[model samples]
Target chain A: MSDRIFGGIGLVIAIFFAWQATLIQTSFISDAVGPKTFPILLAVLLGISSVYFLLKPDPEPDWPRAGRFAEIAFAALVLLAYGQLLPEIGFVIATALTAGYLAWRLGSKPLEAVIVGVGTSLGIFVIFKLLLGLSLAEGPLGF
Target chain B: MELLASLGDGFAIAISWQNLLYALLGCLLGTIMGALPGLGPSNGVAILIPLAFTLGLDATGALILLTSVYYGAMYGGRISSILLNIPGDEPAMMTCLDGYPMARKGQAGEALALSGIASFVGAFLSTCGLVLLAPQLVKVALLFGPAEYFALFALAFATLGGISAKNQAKSLFAAALGIMLAMIGVDTQTGVPRFTFGEVHLYDGIDFLVAIVGLFALSEVFIFLEHRGTEKDATTGPRMEIGRITPTWPMIQSCIPTMGRTSILGFISGVLPGAGASLGSFVSYSMEKKLVDRDGTFGTGDPRGVAAPETGNNAAAGGALVPMLALGVPGSGTTAVLLAVLLALNITPGPLLFQQNPDVVWGLIAALFIGNFMLLALNIPMVGLFTRVLMVPPRILMPIVAMISFVGIYGISGSSFDLMVMLIFGVAGWALRKLEVPLVPIILGTLLGNEMEVNFRRAVTIADGDYSVLISSPLTIVLWAIAIIGFIIPIFVSSTLRRKMKKDERDLTD
Candidate 1:
């Protein structure tokens, strides 16, 4: 079941966390419970919980079909790409592309997606950046 | 009289033009944010927080704005439930049971108006509860030591299961994950870097704001992408006309007692650690149904049915503020967001908060009172606007949601690395949610992790690494008992509640 896989992954994470906790350097002046104590305790707690989850797995999760999975994966990728591209292409351009792509995939007609994307990017830029004085990533055009 | 005198000064500050304007703007924005079916209040507040920060408001102005968004979102949540059979927030789910039915029976307007009134009653009564209770809690919190604080934080994690998550293990796991996330920054007490992984940005640890915007906001985009292929995928109901807008004097008269009693019950639930508005609404609805549903009219569009949960959840929303102000441990996820705001503003909420920042605290309470009235006015005349928001295509809406997340987080943190971390949390949050893990515990863990660790460290150091110090005191013992009972009791009770919450009422609106 997916629960076992989740638990196995959790177990792996716990082990890695324990190793990292062990590696943390403590100053000589620090008290009895150093920085590593809490993290190590957490790792042990996670280890026990993961073992329990593995032993008593829940029912199989209702997973999507492969094509549906691809769509979900792509959506996540778009979010990732939006964060990645924000600095490169500037906020407005990056946000426009990201929002336009997401809107288009979310069921807007292509033209409507473009319009929605442009409007959203501009609206936020003017309101959030220009008016409110919140900083955004600047492109070559200075907006 | 101490409360009275402080409240007088509070009114003076809260009545300022700048503070009132922030409150009004926050109310307008929160209603729209919450009405956009699926964004809910947590994300609504989270998305708009950057704006609050950027607006250059003082802490008092921000507090007024904060109360507005809080009450405004509470009001807006019921709109989608009544019109679209979709809960605009977790607490609003209860409203859908009778609200959609009322809407179908050509009473949508009345339902909106009545729930608005019930919301006012709940908010008003609970703010009174907050005024009376927070000072008392501050007195009690002063008795807490590091050991007792450790026990209290553990109790919080145990009790925060709420209604949605049936698996306690998953909630615990999420909590652990959040603590580890919190450990990413350099250790505060020691100069040692804990888990920065050689990344310079990791030195600051995971910003709870970035994590919040990502977890609550961006994951919503993913969930929307998953469920929404077309307009008709989730919602199945007729676009009924919102008949008369007013609940007649008779209807309001009948539900008056229900709203009054549920507000009290809901306030108590909200005051309980880990018991948030979800439980508040659920318990109130069930209690009222048992008390008054003699003809089984609780769910079949009964006015009391709509009033009970509305009052309960809104009251619970106000109740959740009590602990956050007095103890600094947020009783609900939204309060957790507000807690972050307080911390970012350099206001440490605890027993000292009363003595240190009377203006901020009193002003906040006074503004909450004013904001409740503002919400009532907005919810009634603006029901049409909210329902129309429900009809907005996900095509346009989801992107705006996504855009807001990006822009908001970017603006608030002003760091691309934080944005990337946010996206990562977003993906992981989506994965964790699919696995049925509760996100609130994760948030609570992140918010409280450093404090929890420091308390434990302080306790241990004082006792010279004596582990028994963790449960040495009566207060710690009591907190531990509640924590243990809270984590275990849900296993037996959730099944019954889950069965009661079956998906049978799918077509309440036909």
Candidate 2:
């Protein structure tokens, strides 16, 4: 997005936050500036800065091309999916799958990627769970 | 003197076999981390906080290890900058101007050696400064009340804004957004949720580590992915000859003066809340170029050119520790991560830290002294080995980094929700970086937001609701003046400088 559009969006978010700040209910007011004061101050500062950005945007906004957007989106999806699957499928399996996929995407041979994936996954599991004694999510195939 | 006595005690703790070993491990890990492209001291420390906790080291041991890593990374950053022409971190960016030229000229080994020595000298001397200056600074810090703290934070913000990317407004906005994020969770004073939106997990607020790891490490991975195929044609430079790893005595002698000057300059810059290692290295390099490199050989493999930035950056690393040690404020992002570690350990840093936790404070200082020496020894001999890390392909390295971030955060919080938060912030951080919004101020704002609010409220309460109390104190007045000037001068100076440069170009054309 262009700086002007991003700034406009930021301004809207800041306005929403400012309104939310007004709704914060404080039970006991010990100080002159209660809980809402700082948030309001921050929201106002953000709103003003957004307006400044809208007034003068960068001439050449260095946005990534559409070609590279797919890669970035894929990586983000992989991470989000990894987070979701970490507890459900457990550490080793989730890590292996995600790491393998990412490595392969980045140009590692499929076999090398698989080795790296399983190795890193098990390696970290051993280090954190066994050596450091931290509890990690255990998969169906324990250890 | 009490300083001497405390330092003596510090040595006793630091010299213990366990602490010494931890320091060594930290230095080794820190150097490896620093040598890796796109992973600097801040990311190194942030990614390893959980590991430190998992090891169950006492506060002093954990601090010694982590701080040793911090210093070690400063030393190791020059390795990649000199060898691969890819700076391992921002502070090492200056090193690339000269170090890369030296490498292309087959003086890579000598460049690496000089930077190692320079880093040692810079870190060692600045640590000595820390030993001497921190106690006195802490005494001054003890005198600061809520009003003073508020002003001090303002000064920090203003200075950060000044040093941030050319757009001061954007930097301020990012900082404000960070503060807004910090407002999530239940308010300590009012027992009301400000922005939690009724989520039970939001009661304690967002974890700063999660934010840091996502913003720095994960965001870095996304960028790495964006440029992955583009760098396939890039070549690793000539292998460093081991025999040339040791600088000639005269070459070392020439850099001594430059190192001395830059170390002092770097230390002072590091002590400032906003100006960290990058500024120190930049200022030192520019100053050295103007002062000594009159023949115009600065960017073309000059040893002194390599020395100035290497020394300045490492010295600045030591200097950056002062605020976090003396005042509960972090002077840089890396130190902010360190502060987070301390907070996680249930240790509050400030004037009281010295009296309340002398072992943690003093032991860390003494460990820094040892860590610098260890880094010099490790970096000079292992320069070749460290450079080999550049050969590690991003495909393998980046996924491991991601795993470390995932496992490390999970180890600490043991919550899947935080992992999701990290992933979300990682994408947000990448977008923000693309937009040129500086991340340091955001981290600083989040770290200091609660304290800033608490101090502001406390000052107001003490003044019986008189808002003027914030500006009443002499110290606060001076800080406010500095803050205001800091904001105005940078914009004014840069514009004039740009105008002059343009006019000069036009004149040359004529």
Candidate 3:
């Protein structure tokens, strides 16, 4: 059951946190309680609750695995790539690509997505760079 | 009398051509963002924070714009719920029960009218409460110390299990995850890296804006993908006839009580961290259900049902400000974001706020009055207009929202690095949604993480590592007791609900 798994995971996480806190050296601010105290307490609580959940599982069904995984993964990667790529291409191009890809994934036709993407990029460029006058990169691919 | 004089000065500053423009811009953009399901006031502010910084507006002017956006979004949230049975925010969900029903029966215009009126009433009434109560609250907040603050944080965290999810442990896990994430970055007191893993950017810790976008906006995108290819037929309801958009006199009179009670209840709830407008709405709905039920009219187009939560949620938005300005503690996620902005502005909110920075305080108070009226006027004529926004396809809308988020972030740092972090978190946030872990805690954690750590450190140093120092002070002891009570009572109540649910199922089976 999901509760059992969640509880087990929680317990492991609590233990890991407890271990991490051990490395935190005590100081004036850390004092007698130190950084480790609260985390250790939380770890124990998590460990206890996880065991309790294992003993008494609820009957409700877990959320269905909608094909959301693929969309989320790809879109996230594109966003990460966009961030890294923004300095290479200008803000407008990088933003347009990011928007275009997201739009397509959201079910817009390619042409529609591209148009929206470009429109968004231009809109942002006008607002932040031109109107607000925030200095942004004009990269290798000029604005 | 003095309040009026101060208010006059506030208006003088707020109504200046420059400030009015910022207020107007914030209100318009805020309404649109708030109307989108899943994006609330916090993100609305966080996404645009960098812009405020870039513009370098006077602190008062910037605050007015962001605060307007905050309330404007609260007003806009009602649109989606009334029209499409989709709540723009969780608090708006109650409105849908009666609002959408009314819309289905060809009274879409009337439903919009009622929600707008209720939102205005809630906002107006609570601002009155703010003017009256804020000073007194600040005086009380002056007595608090590190122990009390920690206790307050604990109490706030305690409420998560009550409202966040069905599983209490999961909520606790989420809260712990938040606490740990808050612990990330350099330890303020010791100058040691807690969880930075040597990432230079992270030495400053996870930015709340990046975390918030990931938790709310990006996670929402992922959730939207789940409901992908599952578009319902565009809402088909009666076309409106006229502009006499007033509720029946009796209906209006009845809602006055609901409005009054919800405003008070909402303000009190908003004064507490973790218990937000969403919870206030839920609590008000259930209370109204118990109090004003006769023929099951509460849900089936009974206007009171729609009005109660609307009033509660909106007033709760105003009430949430009480702690932020008075105590320097943010009572909800949105207020947390506002606190970050205040910190960025070099304006620390607390008892001294009233004496040191009366302009920011009075300006905010005065603007609440102006903003609420503007929102009402805007919401009424624009009801039909806002409904048309829902007609736009997700493909187009998503790109625009994403672009704004991306560009707004880039403008903040003027570095591609921040954008990259935003993307990484956006994806991780989306993925976390599938796992059913709540995202708000992650944000609340990241925002409050450093503050909580620093406070605990301070308490320890003050006590000279005498562990008992955390609870030695009377204020600390009282807060700790409250925190303990807050944590325990909810678990028991939820467990009781779960048991009752099991019994009901068994009876049905038999």
Query: What does the interface RMSD come to for each candidate?
Result: 1.3, 1.4, 3.2
The lDDT of model 3 is: 0.72
Runs off by more than 4 Å, candidate 3: A1-67, B1-8, B160-165, B231-254, B272-275, B286-296, B495-510
lDDT tens readout by residue for model 3, B1-510 = 887788888787778777777777777777887776556677678777766866787898888888889888888888788777677877787787777767666677777788888888888888888887888887777787877777666765666444334666555666667777667677666566765656788788776666665566655565665565754322333343333456677877878788778777877676665577877776777688778867767666678878888988988888888877887766666777787678767787877898888988888788778788778878777777776766666657766767777666776667776777776677656544545556655666666666676677677777777667777878777777876666666555756654553453243223
lDDT of 1 at B481: 97
**Model 1 accuracy (lDDT, Cα):** 0.85
Worst 10-residue stretch by lDDT in candidate 2 chain B? B501-510
Query: What are the fnat scores of the candidates, in the order listed?
Result: 0.73, 0.79, 0.55
- Judge candidate 3 at residue B197 and give its lDDT: 58
What is the docking quality class of candidate 3?
acceptable
Report the C-alpha displacement of residue A7, candidate 3, in angstroms: 5.2
Listed per prediction, chain B TM-scores read 0.96, 0.94, 0.89
Question: Which one is best on TM-score?
Answer: 1
